[model samples]
Target: MGAAFRARTPSLAQLFDEDMLGDDLEAWLNESFLLKRTFRTCAVIAGLIDQRHPGKEKTGRQVTVSADLIYDVLRMHEPDHILLEATRHDAATGLLDIGRLGSMLKRIKGHITHRRLDRISPLAVPVMLEIGRESVHGEAHDFLLTEAADELIIEAMGIGHTAGE
Candidate 1:
């Protein structure tokens, strides 16, 4: 039975890595578009920790994130607000402040509806949906970054064209 199970499935660490990557990508997108803040990464990490190990904040249960994973995501995304030194951690501490996380979540939720309506481009919605799916289930981190850069270029060009006319 053990041999058969081993032959048919991925190891637990592999599965956990995939899950963590997915969550990290989701959190990246949420930080990029919705929250537009680097500190929101901490909020996202805290939320994931809470989901995995509930009641930590209230019960004083220790919730922690792998600093390496956080650094990798931040390096890739290059959020405007994160400082280089912030990712470093001592051997014994969690990266996020649990007390601040709840308030960040509340602020994000409160602003989302209005922000979504104001910010999302109608033409980009379909592509955004595809990007969302790719972000969640596929390795499309570069794709998302490229799309955002291209969009900014196109918008800038449009502005230049309008100004010339």
Candidate 2:
């Protein structure tokens, strides 16, 4: 937690209530797809995607694979896979790091002094606006990446044709 990183944003700060502790925090996190996203991200870092393969331009019988399918297979077959565990350990954001965050959560949950806010809060307007913004930007970014990948694939084919090897 660097002082420079602290921009005094109340968005995340306001979500915390004194009554709600670690178990609540874990529950809150479970609702998000952060685990799956982290797994994919770590998969790339772990060299599982294989974006680089020499002479890929002339590869024959190439088969396209959907990321969702791979994730489904891994999840169903090996729930406690190294990739998923690596996500918890090596993820840049450390959102699911069970070591430090889990310990802090245990300490927080130990204090069973009073009841808590069982339901969620009412920050509907801002959340929707942020989500809308993210959706637009995410779609645009994804399109740009797709375009770049298509260009690479076409260029690779051209190389194969011209070289005739």
Candidate 3:
């Protein structure tokens, strides 16, 4: 007789980390396949991100965000509930709204926190664009880019880096 066999399973973190996975719902399902330890890791990361960013607002190309609170909230919940809250639109220009972007960030952070990982700090503006890129493009991208450009102008003025090259 053939020997009995069990299929190897994947973890929630791995699934979410996969480039193709669309959102949190997909990641949660991925968790079912993971070993206990992996699941814990996933949850920790989600929690940390959540604790770090709390209130999120759309502010041109990048959303005005608070990292600490977001990390804490994520540690307490599952992804299913969070993804359900995100509205799907054209991948291009879909997540441009700061309100929506903030919510999504919260969800992502929440996912990390639940897994019990430390929150990432020194939150860079580029990080926000990268995270939301999958859902934004075209005019939306332009809008964000323009906003970033304007901010650079204001920031540059404050620092005074003259062009003399």
Candidate 4:
């Protein structure tokens, strides 16, 4: 959201400009948290997870590994696995009704109002912010932290922003 970047420093947003929703909805909502949530949901559905078990106190380790570890292992070794695909595909492409979703994307491609914003738009703030805040997900933790530290050194030597800062 441009409001998040209005002054180059994050200020709590106060105004609301309800934007039109379209096929690009997928782009905004697809993030690791949503995927992880979907995996946990699907894991429960697939009977791979038992999120609610009576008298079963959840441990910290269990909290950390609920569905993510299984999902990650499956993703690495069995990328074609249904649950793995569901983790990504469900959240990324299932935001709206399945029947009409495909047509909306095609319409977006050649729509009369198609254009790119010069600055980050308000609707894009969540997904963009999510990119940095996902250090705990997959290999992103190592890669993002290393990249940020490298940028810190580069910034010390006069360089560019870190992770789209």
> What C-alpha lDDT do the candidate models reach, one value each?
0.47, 0.56, 0.40, 0.61
Tens-digit lDDT string for candidate 3 (8-116): 1343444334343346534443332222223333434555222224575444655334332332344356434332222111211342333455465556742743222
Q: Model 4, residue 25: displacement in angstroms?
A: 12
All models, RMSD in angstroms: 19.5, 16.3, 21.1, 11.8
Off by over 4 Å in 4: 1-31, 53-56, 59-64, 96-165
Tally clashing residue pairs in candidate 2: 0
List the candidates ranked by lDDT, beginning with the highest. Answer: 4, 2, 1, 3
Off by over 4 Å in 3: 1-136, 160-165
lDDT of candidate 2 at residue 103, scale 0 to 100: 61
User: Of the candidates shown, which would achieve the greatest lDDT relative to the real structure?
Assistant: 4
- Determine the backbone clash count of candidate 3: 34
TM-score of 2: 0.37
Candidate 1 deviant stretches above 4 angstroms? 1-52, 58-139
Q: Model 3: what TM-score? A: 0.16
- Which residue window of length 10 is worst by lDDT in model 3? 1-10
TM-score to true structure, per model: 0.25, 0.37, 0.16, 0.39
Q: Output the worst ten-in-a-row residue range by lDDT, candidate 1.
A: 84-93
Task: Give the per-residue lDDT digits (tens) of candidate 2, residues 19-103.
Answer: 4545765554433356556666777778666443576663465435644456667868985888766765654346556565546
* Minimal lDDT window, size 10, model 2: 10-19
